[model samples]
Target: MTFQKISILFACLFALNTFSQFQVDADVRARFEYRHGFGNLFPDNTDPAAFVTQRTRLNVNYKLEKLTVLMSFQDVSTWGDTKQLAIGDNNNSFSMFQGWVQYAFAPTWAVKLGRQVISYDNQRIFGGLDWAMQGRFHDAALLKYKNKNFIADFGFAFSQESQRNENTDFLLQGAFTYKSMQYAYLKKTYNKGLVSFLFLNTGFQDFTDANNTIVDGVNYRQTTGTFFKFPINTINFEGNAYYQSGKATATKDLSAYNLALEAIYKPNNTVFGLGFEVLSGTDQNGSSKNKSFFPLYGTNHKFNGFMDYFYVGNHANNVGLNDLYAKAVFKTGEKSTLLTKVHYFAANNTLINNADTYLGTELDLVYSKNLLKDVSMNIGYSHMFASNSMSLIKSGRSNNNTNNWAWVQLIVKPTLFSNSK
Candidate 1:
């Protein structure tokens, strides 16, 4: 074994000797995808991509009364991509997905530090992007308080590329992604219902010119929102509203908001749901400041459409969106289910160059089955009927062909070792 592996093994052994309890678990997921048009666009004359990707994770847990610790190692990649590495240069796909320690000194307060996942409400603002094989994690610290009916969490994070660079400019991966962030989340539970409030503040970095004569500029943005869900008899309803202010990452001015409402009826194995989301958009006029709202760090795939043509990395600094959709779910058996969804999308307003408002329609279908106690499988398909607007927005073509995609996935989770009492 390498030095790193040996060091980790020794550390694990030491922790086991000192900790009051320890446990271990593992997860493996493989997905085979046939992508004719998965994302917004594909190059011309390119055949559909068919490949298998896998993610494997091993987790260790330690607990001692008011203190708890967790560490997870993850590797995500396609098959046969990392075989027979060259000398001294190894495959670098493995990473620490989560490593955190939580300690509670008071009965109602606790603090957690290190890398972790932050998800709230319906994961509209901050989410763990589980759809992606690598998933998502944040290196930060969090303080949480909870009781029977109330819970609250406060988190802060800052990112830097290196320690000895002596650089003043913040290194941002993208313009829209945050370089620094903080948030406050509060939740209250009522009989048969619950409500959550969130406030998130983010900042983006802008470096000066090459000569370093100018000060690096920074843009700050704030998002405040509330989410509520309640059940009335046999029907369940939820609503969300969020507003954004302050300068955008790339623009000098920003003012935006988004609102949504949804209802679900599930009296039996069959279920039905309907929802609508409205996001403010910028006007086509040059004088109008940008009014488009963005759900930063959200699970966009869960909304809009699975094809990710709307908010999954595109559509920023552009026209906003409106998504109206319906879904039906039928449980075939105790271990099998089928789900179908339909969506109609439109631009909140015309584009800057005066394009049409109707974007397109999409259909999605999925089937899931539990093969064994620790294994599950899923198959999904999606088709997008692009309109003149969608084609113009995604591709330059105003008259493009239909887009289709398919995928099959299998998940396996197991506990390798557990000797805690």
Candidate 2:
């Protein structure tokens, strides 16, 4: 059906339904960044880069007795990318970030379909990467069940380039997105802690030929993990363990693992935490099987370091990482706070010639303040101190250069309309 016709039908349904709720909201954010070495080590004789990026979103939500709907329109662009008087945007930045519908068939069972955000326990494997200008989403369907202390979800998806009468080859151009995916998640809650389990299966097209031709049907991989959080007095302990197996490519086999543990202590207005994490890596000398563990479709920026030296679209399938970090959050004022974090990084596998395992150390600081009821501001800075081994992994880049990044961001979220029965 046409979009206009569907809108009219929804309008009619809204009018006929007496017991319903509707709401509209907006999220506008702009950030300015100064990057000297933001994703990678800085090269010599190169100037720093600075730019501003913005993301604007409009969300409409509706709810009835057994149905819920959400439509989120988003636009993301860098400042000065478009002319002031341009008839249209230079690049197509407008898109439907999320358009989903849910229907509850039973008291504790429901199904959701369409483009939506799928995030789970600590966002280890699935997350809504809201830190990026254009967040991540999935076009899939989910079967959901929730009760007093138990929850479960089953998800499935398939991707194709376009409508074609030929073979079913997913040649969608862009990054290496999955060809198909399926997952199941279960969680049980208790008085003091909760534990969750996730089992994911993802498939990729076998593009083995030099010309990017599809050879085999598909190669599949599996990820199984568990996450748990428990509290003891004023301290909380959380951890996760995950393993990956199956085919990484048409030829290479995948075998990897990730383990993490964290402890947090909250006292009064201050929070302190210490964490240790390790992702299995492949040997530098080379191996027939791939052992690097990649955390697919997760908020990786929240880990490692704010400088994004690992994962955030880079450092995949290479020497994996070992990150030991500590963080502190302090309430500076009634409406302001400060956060500081330090990370010590190393290679999980033997480096070339078995070089030093210590990669580098990073320091991150962020200050946040609430300006108004629905407005907030944040400023952050990060510095990276690299070692010789870090230079080896980063393509022999000079680690002697000073590496730092800074950013300032402003966010405004406002409720435009709301009607509840």
Candidate 3:
């Protein structure tokens, strides 16, 4: 079946090129950041860090009657990190960011394969993670079906280290990467509301025993969730609920959950909103089962404050988070906007030695403006007012230290070539 699909796709591609559409585009983004306590509490007597990073990408897309193909190449690097007169780069930061092909066999059915991005809904479970200089991609295959107001997608992925004639032992290492993954997503759309359901199963290679010996097997984990959005007049409400279970390791049993709700009111050119979220956590003392909830592949930096103090490559399998936030957005000019948000943070589980649960409060401000048709700029600042309890989990640093971060970013995207144009 796979061979037949590929053959049909190529045949269509060759026959329809004369009447097909092809396009080329580019994206360039540069960001400068000043970090005093970006991801953690600032310790006393430590100098703040400043740096600039950039991501440049070239994208090619081709579309025929029933087939489509896309390829993207990108280079991500930091300024002042390479030698001016070097013959070549040692880091090899250039890579194929995405290469995918899709073929629609029926009016409402299609199959897509290759390296691609899997993001849906609010991105609380899976996301593209475009904020990172090196964005995320998955090598997988998907089967999609869609009708008037209903859609369904089934995805599968498997990984291996290399071709070996002897055994199927995968030693490829990563903190959150899975050896195998399968998922199903379904969505229903109404007049002004939508609801979606997702079920994902991920398997990890288990290679170590209790005594640190070699074992060959796989441990599986499961995540199930639902997301919904509804609008009533000028107020919109959105929420999500998710649960995680199964084995996190060879010997550990997992049990965790996440819940969130938000309401937004957009009257005229101004917007206001309020939100609350909870992620289950393990007890500080100890427990027979694990309870900490991790968002896995979500765009976590977009949540829990832009400062990324939680769930951005840190804070896993520990005390979970409870966040209550309020935000407002104002149109400052014809092409400019300003946003302000405040978050009150706390713990979802009991703290060690009966410590306080109140972690800290954060304030974030962002200003954005469009300079040209394809150019835009953004400036942001965030401050964390830490409490004594926050010091307990964040390296025991002094809460009195000034904890703040600031950044500026510029983005430009242009269409280099288009057949239709």
TM-score of each: 0.93, 0.95, 0.93
Indicate the residue-level lDDT of 195 in model 1: 94
Best prediction by lDDT: 2
Segments of candidate 2 deviating more than 4 angstroms: 1-19, 173-176
Candidate 3 residues 1-421, lDDT tens each?
1345446545644554464687778899999999999899998889999999999887778888898888887889999777888765557777778999999999999999999999999988989999998888899999999999999999999987787788666676665789899999999999999999999999988876544337578899999999999997888999999999998777899999999999999989999999999999888888889899999988888899988889998888888999999999999999999999999999999888979999999999999999999999999999999999998778788899999999999999998767841
* C-alpha lDDT values of all predictions: 0.83, 0.91, 0.89
| lDDT, candidate 1, at 26 | 85
Look at candidate 2 and give me any clashing residue pairs: none
Q: Compute the lDDT for candidate 3.
A: 0.89
lDDT of 1 by residue, 82-117 (tens): 556543215576788999999997999999999998
lDDT of 2 by residue, 96-197 (tens): 899999999999999999999999888879989999989999999999999999999999999987888988898764444889999999999999999999
Model 1 scores a C-alpha lDDT of: 0.83
